[model samples]
Target: MPTLETLLLQLNSIKVIDDTIPYSQYIPLDLSISNLDLSQIDIKNPNDFEIYIETYLKKNNAKVAFGGYNEVRNLYKQSSLFGDGQVNERNIHIGMDLWIKAGTPVLAAIDGIVYGFDYNAGKGNYGPTIILKHNLENHFFYTLYGHLSIESIENIEIGSFFKKGQQLATLGDSTVNGGYSPHLHFQIIKNIEDHFSDYPGVCNQKDLKYYLKNCPDPDLLLKIK
Candidate 1:
């Protein structure tokens, strides 16, 4: 059996985001405090986060701010969903986040059937989420799209089929998207383990090894570089 990394390298044409913006338009943005200067701004607030994203994008002359997988961040500290106040904090993001404007159309990366959809409303939640199931080279896997607008899941049905590049959902604003800046949390799951429209997009240090393996780098499939 080929590893997920192997499969990703084999399948070289997969693209999760729209190709209208050339790959040069995408820039890497580090949310972690170690690299970015966040001394004056509150990283937890969505407005401030948005400002930071916009400022950084403009400074770098890029349209999309990409990269977040395995990044340890402070944005999840405000919510108990990430084990806030706990000894082992779930601050390590296990998926890639595409920092773009709200209402941006999210497209399907491959032909798949909608496994499920859910509205997980709360602070530091996935917000409107969708799960799609696909089979490639006899390997069954799932893709998760998070931080989507409420309308994204409106009238969405399970088992719905979508072709590659099909419009799947739209990015949600901070108010509805877990109080964070608008972005798409894209993840690939090798084994869902009964999870429906939701899965852990972040993990604690204690569970890093497990999640790092289960939710491999989305860039492998996105090929955004």
Candidate 2:
């Protein structure tokens, strides 16, 4: 079987964020152990996190930031929804996050129909979410767009077709986007299975092996680097 990464490598281009944002202006962010910036924010305060994000973009003179597939993040530590009892806290993220200003236009990476959508309201949740079903090459897979505004999913249907680079949704603010900074959490899934509207974008270390395969490195297709 050709792995998700192998299939993604065959694609020439895929853009989840608006194509209008130039590649040169993209600042790749790191929230792992190597980053000094992640330490500046108080995980409990959304405004504090947002301020750091805004400052980082301004300092670098960049419009948007990208990266974070399989990247371990400390942002979810404050939420019990991620860490409770038997579940060993899911901190390892499995998506390519495109961090930019709120209300930024989000685009479809490829031509696909809306598979499902929902308002996952809660702290550390995806907020307004949408999943698109696509048949790329011979593989039937799905793409998830997270942290979108409520309006984004207001008029969407189960089978609404969207063209590549088409304006699909707009990013949401901290009030709706799980109390973090504004950004689009874009992820690719090999098998959506029984999940719809909401899926695990972050996983615990014990479950990393399954998620890493279930959700391949989106950068393989985004090729932002």
TM-score of each: 0.96, 0.94
What overall lDDT goes with each candidate model? 0.87, 0.87
Cα RMSD of all models vs. native, in order, equals 1.3, 1.6
Which whole-number lDDT from 0 to 100 does residue 102 have in model 1?
94
| Clash count of each predicted structure | 0, 0
lDDT of 1 by residue, 85-107 (tens): 47788899999999999988899
lDDT over C-alpha atoms for residue 38 of model 2: 70
Q: What is the alpha-carbon lDDT of model 1 when measured against the actual structure?
A: 0.87
In terms of lDDT, model 2 sits at 0.87
So what's the TM-score on candidate 2? 0.94
lDDT of 2 by residue, 1-225 (tens): 776578789888667887887778889888775676677668568888778777888999998888888888787877877887355988899999988888999988888999999999989999999999888767899999999998999999999999988989999999998887899999999888899888999999999999998998888888888
Overlapping backbone residue pairs in candidate 2 total 0
